[model samples]
Target: MTDTIPNPESEGPSGGWGSVKSIARILGDDKPSPMVLEELARQNKPGGVMCVSCAWPKPANYHPFEFCENGAKATISDLTSARCTPGFWSDHTVQSLRGWKDYDLEQTGRLTHPLRYDEASDRYVEVSWDQAFDDIGQTLKSLPRESVVFYSSGHAGLEASYLYALLARTYGNNNLPQSSNMCHETTSVGLQKVIGSPVGTVVWEDLEKADAFFFFGQNPGSNSPRFLHPLQEAKKRGAKIVTFNPVVEQGLVSFVNPQSPVDMLTGRETQISDEYLQVKAGGDIAAILGLCKVVVEADDAAVSTGAARVLDIAFIDEHTVGLESFIDLVRSTDWSVIEKESGLTETAIRGAGELYIQAERVIGVYGMGLTQHSQGALNVAMVVNLLLLRGNIGREGAGCCPVRGHSNVQGQRTVGIAEKAKLIPMDKLKALFDFDPPTEDGVTIVDAVKGMMSGQIKATISLGGNLVRAVPDQKAMEEAWASQDLTVVVSTKLNRSHLFPGKKAYILPCLSRLERDEQASGPQSVTTEDSFSHISGSVGKRTPASKHLKSELAIVTSIAKATVAPNPKLKWDEWTADYSLVRDLIEATYPDQFGAYNERMFEPSGFYRGNSAHDRVWKTEEKKAVFTTPKQLNALSFDDAEGRLRLITMRSNDQFNTTIYGYSDRFRGIEGTRDVLLMCREDIRSAGLSEGQEVKLVSDFNDGVRRELAGLKVREHNLPRGTIGAYYPEANVLIAIDHHDELSKTPASKAVPVRIEA
Candidate 1:
């Protein structure tokens, strides 16, 4: 079946769900996957099944009608009956495929066989698993291990990620450039710097007991729907849930819990946030500073009037430091400056502060929205500062929560994906494999792209992801791809990455987590660590898409054997043939937690990885949770210019990350078209544009790139002035490579300044 691109003109304005034309434009010209309907059927089955996308098990605790709209869409996407067999690659050359749209490319379906780029034919031809591994091994053997960079995506399983890291380390390079570097690296960097750990200090259960919840720059309704339930519960309990984001996300203000039986049956929706404050773009640091100022003022007044105690004196004196400096900074800063910088009035800032002071416990939850900014690290530290003031850390229902995107992204970092100049993972690899791993720090994702573009790097082996679309400066990334000697992609379906093949490119099809993994022992179960540090078993419920397709673990093992001589002490074949052996190796490597990895996962509900922060055991050198003082008192704010606005790139309700599941974002009233820019009515009128006016938004970055998204209809959203919103992947073009957090190297996707043109 030939795929069809949707016409952009047929899509209507950005009011409530645009007309059919907009849907077509958003989906491009691709035909609906036959698997979509099939997947929907499975989703609506009597007993809910596991989603193949995130490996999220069907929660049994909730009512029968527990699925969210996005969950249903994710299930349908996995069930898509698209197939891109070896013949399709044989028919189309890499050059020809390059011209195809991203939607059409993925619509081709799951790859059926291992394929290698045949430069002579200019096409990807089918190759046997053995030959493919042997060739990849030869390539690795030929190059200095430092030259071979292993890139991992969030979509990969824990087993696959572990193997990828092992392969790279075994081959003598720790150059593991991963997807996390682009997303939540700021959280890891900031939290570690302040609290001496990369993970969040709170568990999911803590959300329920918190008196007040401070949500910073995250829209759970669209990003992680599962979180909506907890927020809903918090709201129902009369807890004040305050939101701080540039855009007034519908999910944060109110949400219809499709999982709640009464809400689903009666079409009832619950209010999520008691107070939603739209802070200026890139102004999180300022807003937080303003809030801290209010806290400090309230405490001084309380002490003077003898009304009530504002400061947690006992907790502060026992567990923290730098209180005097923090208070001094807050006192020194004036309300006028804070209001100007945060775009929030003194009343709103004080009200937020009053809520914080009155609450017995408060939990601060944030996502990439808070981390992907120029002052991302400081913003994080500021949030930590607020918690420290209240003695929130290591206490019940009060701490820091960095809501990670991928299911196992955090776990990947924990296992050994560090790109730091100094870490002992390489030394551990040397002890385990009896081979000296590279001591030199490896390139991160951005660094790898720069290296490839500058001809310092030769080959890139991506475990699973659409790297080209995910990274910034697509044109530069494409150029870097053209310069590479070889580019290997291990994936289940065709994506934008497959089209951007190098001179010699290979596409190796692998098994999805939902598909049964048949090893010599039997069906295997993989474990994933969620944002809360809960390690759960993921067992496949569906049959393999194709018998020829190999498990990612098997493929990685084969490649590893082909690349290096087997260690006399370790049995690589045994581990590959049985996943238990791999688990045993992991348990042996990290004995502190996974002493008996196989036994623990078999339990119906898996175990929680011990979090030292959960019990208030501060692991800092001083053995106390330290209060970090903000370097600057004023919040970071941008000035509004003619035709210029600060644009925040967000996911549509129907989308997740780069995968455009469907065109309709019900919450935003955006339908069919993904190109529409969201701007407040006043901002639109100020720019001399009408509701449905065609316009070009040019980036204010040094690169001076322009994105032509025509005729965006203006909606009177309760967003901050001088700020607008756009969907990602498309808007990704507007973000420059240099616009990144200094400490974390995370791209500032949330704070790109742009101007609309007629």
Candidate 2:
């Protein structure tokens, strides 16, 4: 085995002309800039604000170029003149449309109006908004409260998300699963349990001032390119940036800032990570544990010898609990176990730890790589423990930062969207809206599929997102969806989820964040929260693709009014009329925190929803941040079977969540394909496979059912010996419904045991 994999020679620093080329392609494919100049002008004419792509906090002083390449693609895709009209649907049957790729389906165009699937004709026909809402209302009234569930996407605004949650509860159901369940549920659950906060404590400004940053399980280059700016600035300022992952991401390798003309023109690049360690899949716990062990040993040695202290004794003693027990677990853990699990030598772990020991201020940032595991929650908690050792929390340029991949995932949760009832009490709802909310736990994504399988949940309403394409065990999920009595999707474009029709299904078109949403009062502005808990306003400027399309808030209010009628106190109509009123209600529900929601939202930089952990004010039962001792290190174990390997699912640079932007992942040097499996050369040879050889992958699971995907091409890469990588949604088939984080129910998409056959 080699100590380091050879870096590709063909690769160049990110954001040279490559970003311009990609953006041009996106604009060219959807609508040439010249052709859609009017649409672009309409979208940014006046009083228009905020980038529609991501929830990254904006600067206090706004600029015309606040958007990024990805943001441009997202905006162009939304405002595309191409239309998926009734004629287009008539020409392409549902079965026929299924053959088109996810990107092609979306590229076909913006959904023009509400549509309903007609089984007889095998096509979707246009329907009046009134008729669609009538059907949704009737179906909700027909089913038992427990049998009806509402799902939300992270792209939704705070006002709409709040209304959706309120509507679901007032209608007597708490099955409000969201896209966050698949991504950042671990952050919410783990942080809340440990520090009495469910969101990241550090803001964007902290990254600029940090002395060091540890990035784990996240690829900022492809996932969020805007992040590259701050990372590059930190690197230029001499901050040590360390990365841990199974694959080396180019964006983290080197970035030539596109925003900086000098760097782009001169080919000057800023190297991002100081050291990149390729940890095994699900090996984050072991790796962090080993690093912590090194730091603790050095600190203990220093204290016993009466040397200067390495650990922050005062901070730990005053602000944390369970330290002695946590220290015992880390100290007593054998090095051999850590070595075997982490796929890193003791020297490597200690080398990384030395940075922590030397740094005056440190910030830790991670993505799904830490959260998409069976022990995902434990992974988050362990990171918190690492920071606590040095008084990292409650300080500038230092704290825990879980890079929420989605735009407003943190905000969606804050607006009271949850599966568990105890988390959001019924009493709070009763006082705020004068309605008795449900008081029982509801089904999450996996459980919702189970309910459908058992003939319990008969209907579903998705605020946004491609649920069928996003969940695990696609075959089972598709079967479960097929058995539903009714399914309704509120969306802006057509995707794979709409293809899986229940007995009665409807695709209701809604205005996107980039389009002007005119309510009864006037053009509406909605608020979204960033990963750092800053809530800012997003006011679209373009006209709706179709006049018939309704706003998400309006759709929710209309449905609520029709289904849960005779309730005047709820004021669903008023909330839709003026979004500020919705903010007022949110303020009432969370008085101390959202007390000034409306005023703060309009502030140029937005305002932070104070995190107790940021101020060292732990609100836990112990009145201090608690150190959690996980039961074990890694939750996955591969069989001794010869060809067995740990397989992890990931997104390409061309994709966002389940939305496939294209077939190429420019960062990984992969072009024109998503069917390729990245594996170490040794592993490929051991499996009797050559680079570019076609093979079949079968997942190993406790369930008797066999889940396999064939015709996958093997590609030699720098992954760990026993680990392989594949794009998600396509590889989601390998993940079993039962394989998820127990605490948060997040699917272990990053680690799955499997076998490959030539």
Candidate 3:
């Protein structure tokens, strides 16, 4: 046994002297001080660099050093002094590098030059950009456009993603699957069905107008620490915050803002969540359903007594459809079933719902915890249903806020990075590019992985992401990834996905967000959209890491120019030389959204791309938002399997999506390891297991295929009896690739059924 101890206690309240020191250590870790310092000072400011980390919105009245520890880590990690040169490539082979950790691989640092995988030596060799681009372009042109998938990551800015989408469409395909496909695809698909919009319906300032906040399946304390400031402010102003999660999170409990002088000087901490409910993993919808029953029943009572009704009759009658069915569903649902599934009592759930009923304006916030599940769409739909009951959609400080994880993830989707052909305006595309674009539905992440496995996907052109690690079924993904004909990745630093190269693999070096991207006109400023639907400018001031490196826009343009034959209407070089042309094309493409293009984005406060749902403009068939119901409430609602547990894959304090900075999880009081399974003591006894017991996890999906992970040490936690928590990507091995939500096809990382065996 490893004898690794688990500390369920948090290190301290979120963001104190500890977070600052953590950031300091990373900045001091072989990074150039002056450049990094200057970059930090200008980060998330007017005419400043947008964080390449989380998509949390920035404040208009910014703090002097407006950044979280995670932001600093992301910046320092990318602007590293270490460089991956041709010599470094020779030092490590493809097969040898597979065993390396994700953190170690990225820590080796940025790729200095474009490189191609050599079969004979099993190594990557330096290649000129011209040859690499020509080869990749020729191969893409040779294949049927449907066989190619343009995989864009969350890191790329608006201009690059927009051009990348155009590159895919003009080359004759709609197979543009990006990061959002895996994370928030559920939110997009579900919300669009209900509200006619695929994004959230709130601005950052809306937090100020709220009397209460109901947070579910989100941990901003770790993933998006910058949000703590506003939550802190909200709590200070006596706004009630009700949180629902599987585990105790430090930020939701209390917070000590690093930027606040009083907090640092006096060691004062602000309490965050007034009511913290530890609902079972994937029971958010069930809990929400319970809440609905509470509100509807209360409304009936209020009507009889001639008091204020709990449900908003006017909004429900005029602005929504399927109201009767929704009410019927809520009334028909039994409290026994809700309590059984939600791992919460009727009294507890009603208390939380009462807070919602009392507050005039409420904000409902959620994250991947609710989205990465079998009923992920239902999870989102239920929240909307709850909000609509109180006429919350168009109200100030009261709406649905799906806090996005990575930077520009939403902007990518907004600017046409989608697999659905209908989502892309075919008429506008035909008129603008003057080419016959593919109108067929393309592969999503799940379909793409399946395609690669079955040898249908011939090529994958990634703009920036650790796809293999981010996806499920690790063993199969690696096999299918290496089996492909071509795998092209454009990135600033190396990741595990790069190690599993195809037969003809290429790692193309690109400019980081920290470096100046100068085009033919002069220096350029790229724009990124945030969780709030706000767009801001990012201008990198640091020097380029390598002279041989090219901007992502330049690389994508080269490939497109080489692949597609000369078009008299297209100006590839001109657009690549001056990004303003790309922005102009964006303007023509999304006139209402990006009008004025280059000018409005640089405004000090940025600009909010208004949400129609927020303005009470329903873009659906009947011009009204609908109340959606779950087709089937499966394993996520409850798991009754004997000797089984519901597994939720989570990130630690020192982690991002698929990127674990160190072995230690800062807030969780864990150090030097991430291979431990978190379980409540009762569950351990029930399973005939002891603390720190070495065990193997077996997937219990009843599928013919066998999936097991050995050597994970068990650690006691505060989770519900039938639920266990483990680090994401590490526990991802136990989840089958096809185990996902039916509506959105989002991999159910949060609600896998598994068992521990000694």
Top candidate, metric lDDT: 3
Higher-lDDT candidate of 1 and 3: 3
Ordered by TM-score, highest first, the candidates read: 3, 2, 1
Q: Record all residue pairs in model 2 with backbone atoms less than 3 Å apart, i.e. clashing.
A: none
Pitting candidate 2 against candidate 3, the one with the higher TM-score is 3
lDDT for 371 (candidate 3): 89
Per-residue lDDT for 51-94 in model 3, tens only?
Answer: 88999988889899888888888888878889889899667898
lDDT of 1 by residue, 518-592 (tens): 888888767666676656666665667788998877878788888877787556678777777777767766777
Cα shift from native, residue 201, model 3 (Å): 0.2
Q: Best TM-score goes to which candidate?
A: 3
TM-score per prediction, in order, is: 0.90, 0.96, 0.97
Clash count for each candidate, listed in order shown: 20, 0, 0
Candidate 1 ranges with C-alpha deviation above 4 Å: 1-67, 421-427, 602-605, 621-623, 633-643, 703-718
Candidate 3 accuracy as TM-score: 0.97
